[model samples]
Target: MEIDFAEYQLSSQLRGHEDDARGICVCDNTGIATSSRDRTIRFWTLDESNKRDYTLSKILLGHTSFVGPLAWVQPNDEFPEGGIVSGGMDTLVLVWNLVTGEKIQTLKGHKLQVTGIALDGSDIVSTSVDCTLRRWRKGQQVEEWEAHKAAIQAIIRLPSGELVTGSSDMTLKLWKGKSCIQTFLGHTDTIRGLAVMPGLGILSASHDGSIRLWTLSGELLMEMVGHTSIVYSVDAHSSGLIVSSSEDCFAKIWKDGVCVQSIEHPGCVWDAKFLENGDIVTACSDGIVRIWTTCHDKVADAVELDSFASQLSQYKCSRKRVGGLKLEDLPGLEALQIAGTSEGQTKVVREGDNGVAYSWNMSEQKWDKIGEVVDGPDDNMKHPVLDGVQYDYVFDVDIGDGQPIRKLPCNRSDNPYDVADKWLIKENLPLSFREQIVEFILQNTGQKNFTPDPSFRDPYTGSSAYIPGAPSKSSGVSKPTYKHIPKGPLCRLDVTSGVSPFQRLLGERHSFSFSAECNRHDFSVLCVLVRRNSSDWSASSGFDVIPVTGELT
Candidate 1:
């Protein structure tokens, strides 16, 4: 098979996930499903009345943590529409009924994040960061083994019924049940993705920024090298096109082991897969799933096509204030010629079109580069004043049952979970109501990213903080009184944060994240969705509390 088009263009942008979109499963041409760090899976189907348009069909909410890999099973007697196998950071592999959006079974055993998933006939095969692979038959664990010494990150079933797994050990093993038939070694770093190349051999993507093709007998075939950062995923299309996503913020299309097209994203491209029609679907860190098509008629319309360009221009034109200073008015390199009045003094200098921050080093007698300056959200806008203090929002929360309304103060940049936790602690409310309150805040504020922590304290209750997945003492978990079992200490979440609203959370604590994402406007998108950028905003200090049942959901 061969590709007929010379170039590809943006077809559509699917937006719904509240956090990073992590995995994508294309169900032939029927539909597409994606999992996210937001702890949910969304199914999208083509709107046939409108070509190339996909509409959300269902939302699966079972994973308690970041959902990773997804495998699609064609329609069978067991599942009339189809079936889906999903693995998540919660260490659970779930089988789902695609039509009703219900969990068919929960297969558990892995003690860590479940990374890769594949279907073995009627059974489910899963690999985990815990360094093990397990097979589930009819919802029961039938086989389990350590597939690698390091974390097993990728897995795929071959046509012959044997399984292949890639791992952080930098090796891929061809397995027949518990036996390792052959070991293919070429990746110099962690293997992140694996795909079956139809009648050809196997394909693997790695953290070494390369994609490798390997024969079944442990022989290397072709090495595709173009990605400058970690390649997160790879998929083979029937057209012999290989699509790969990377931390470099690109989804690259390859033909005959050569780079053909590079699609740039606003954030890290986590996963990319091929549709049966040769279109590409990519999951990105910006919490968006975008489609790319070579069909010119299917390309995105003008408004959608200019979105990124519009955002870039808006950032550049509104550079009056960057990190609390008028960055556009900053001095040039000549400002660095004079000695600083004090040690460790910081200064911003204009270098071409960028404002670079530098700090004075008295001992070294030279300025050290700090970082590039970025723009702020809105300088003229007024924040709500509460008790002589300013805040982005002050929400009114009613916990039901005739409870008096309490104030929930928040900044646009504040994590809703954090604010809700602290307000619950202060109001002496049930810590279990934390998620509900967070949802309320998100809905009212039009914000999305809601990263929750593992544990939170009630403070008033004086009980040990309960972890999300741990069996709580209140649940009447049986205690054997074996003191030697060594239960881990309760995690005490610190609610205090005095950092600037302009500052950003380090990317997964990654040491070498892309510098482009640090742009002032880009980082500010975390607080508010920038796609529909708005400035006609006001800070209201009050909210109307809505009544609700005391359900945990």
Candidate 2:
């Protein structure tokens, strides 16, 4: 009863039939069957993966032109027989046992092509080009009624055991038992499809490019504009969503009188049906079937993909405008300066004069120092001095633009004129002072000074030479090579109700080579080998990003 919809974007579509598929049905166990104009019925079994695998189970040969319609009968406790009854342009109805793939019986009575069909209890009802309705009861013709004026295009039975038929004469007739009950005459064009939703009443589509809703008493409820061209089929979901396919090359979803989502197809969407998962399946005129998922939320999340492009497009519409109120400065924050008196403490004051006084709390947002800011010397003292030298040189060095090297011990230079000449070389002096000097030199000189040639000193400061380098790139690290994994041939693989395996042997064998080429600038190809019966694809191939090697590049 859960109605969460899952989505699948088709990587490739299989050309199902040489001609259009006119009839489609899904079984109680979720198996699919489609009858095409190629005079063959194709059967497909579903798996958790939703992989495409269909087998030509049986080629029903009684139809001369093509199979017209099909209805699958569910098995009852009294009779465990599950079967499918089909009508054809050959004026015959064939019942085939779905479990055994055998044609149980052929019911023949219609003089012309059988165009539409439906099921009621164990009986199969059919409408034909001969302007008559025929009912077949277990391979025998039990009832025949003169159903309509012209050819009956579509038909359905009501829950009250009455028959409803649409015709080319622009009228829909309701029949009770063998007698005609009522005739509805509002359509100005030929009726093509019919659907009946109880309480919501009857839904019908026509060549008039309209879908009209009517009550059971033949009263017009609503006439909806469905498509630009003729509408072919319509299906209603229990959630009040309606799916309609048309010759306009699209299928559309409508709910509560508003068009929600429109799905564009390569060809005309001839038929559309809502699946059990709330997703929609559409059969196209080009013999390809597609599934679609639509959301009822505000501005579909998928549309966010083009948000940047949409912003750029909007920018072109109006000229730019700007407005702002600029503020000068916060009172205490103006003269904020960090003076490291002791390790983590800094002195802050509201004056430009430099003086290392007692520490201020730099962690606090205010610039209030612990001691008062001395504007001038004390009256009695001749030498009222700052505690330490305020050196600005160290912070001025730009350590950002540097050639990254693995941390190594710094070797003291033997040259007396080197910048290390300023060091006291005393015990208990931190080793970090030497490391800082080496880092400063590397940041200034870059890779040019480190090239293997001699006399590569800094042009600005020739005091020292650059350190030796490592190999340029990390491409030698772990990498996998995909060599000639053959492009597979386009052949249909029949998958039954079990695990199916299809493998393509590659031209070269792969090894666990750890050499890789990393390119963060461009996307690399990722290969995933999925096991046949995995519930989630990540269960088998848990998202591993394999960096390609020089061979793939």
Candidate 3:
């Protein structure tokens, strides 16, 4: 089915997180839990009276670091209302009772950060940066095994009861229980997100700025390349609609490998998910949780059209009028004298010592230049002075004379031939003059032959074409190798010199400049300046700089 993007609108913006809202998962039909880098998970419930409004039901806390992943378990006989599982940078996985607002269990085993989590049949599977996948049951580790060569970022259980994990090693691995059965390869960068498409395939989002759909046996089916930046998260609905969030500040909906709709955000979209009712929820680095849904009424459609019209109205046509003097508008036009008959004759107008002339062609019914005319009437004059230049000939023509010169001014040179060639090419002279000027230049410059050299051969099939160049040995100059320095406190001045800590950890090299001002006596007040150079990046990479002042002490 063709989905109309214009029908979608932002239903509400949930604002409570102090930092980036990193992950989101639907708890039930009317409830969703959003985890943030602020080390908290917030529960939101849809108001039945107003579908656009979401009430903050509870704020679950316990994780001491950035919460990155979340999964909701279905209600069973053991837990009547179900619970939520969260993985965080604190190297801990916490299971929370959603209705009671209580932490049930804290599963700990991985040495590093927990990156992703998923709910299996009565078991919880979690992947970590420590390169291991651990399965937990009843608040205890059941089975653990190394999953990837690098850190695992995302994990999901397919409808067929098989588990799939995506890792920073640029590959996705399929596992039965704790053993990997097959590995899928195609992405050139880290795989950040994964989602199952039921009977279709598995969708994987990557840092390579592309999303790929693969079969269960690890065959790459198709690739989706709409996002210009790293894709962070992907979620699929039962209706075959896929929603993906990216660092490109956009959340796009895909259907049958085509992007059908896009929701733009002001900051990097960290996570996006589809609710049970087909609504979309996106968490962004701007510390805001936004929900988008299609309305049934014409009022919402009118509002959406108005917004689109306003966006389209931002572009307009710009016009500029050129004004200048033409050669025919100059004084002494009537002073010129005709030398021959008007039918097949040459017209010569003398001014000072040089003459402005034109030759009449009877067949073409047009005037052409004989050779080159200077600003003098004397034909015997060897060197005529014009525009502070001593030229043997200067051609005066009326073509494009009435229009303002669009060509830029250049420095005057002693060689008239070079200046003439530049001017002729710049003005786009007629084909007749073009051939004549080429011939004149060749004749004046002197050439041995007009034919191609007999010794030359086509490079494609030549014998020497396959010859390899001499391999060079390495020079004594040693290339600089950057060491992985553990990030210290933000108070260190050296931390501001190179890339930021976040970029360094992500292995991203960005070029930017920053400045700051602080008072010694009043350590509480400070100001910072940041300038991002995005010309080397994509067009959407440019950002507006806003001044911020706050207490820092």
Top candidate when judged by TM-score against the true structure: 1
| Pairs of colliding residues, candidate 1 | none
Predicted candidate 3 versus true structure: per-residue lDDT over 412-478, tens digit per residue: 2212223433454345432123223323323333321232223433221231111012122132222
* lDDT (10s digit) by residue, model 2, range 315-385: 32222111110011111333344344334333322222223234444465433445543334333322212
Clash statistics: count for each candidate: 0, 7, 6
Error of 3 at 189 (Å): 0.4
TM for candidate 2 is 0.50
The model with the greater lDDT, 2 or 3, is 3
TM-score ranking from best to worst?
1, 3, 2
The segments of candidate 1 whose C-alpha lies over 4 angstroms from its true place after superposition are: 1-5, 311-353, 356-553
Q: Would you list the C-alpha lDDT of every candidate in the order shown?
A: 0.76, 0.55, 0.67
Top model number, lDDT: 1
Worst lDDT window (10 residues) for model 1?
Answer: 482-491
CA lDDT, candidate 2, residue 182 = 83
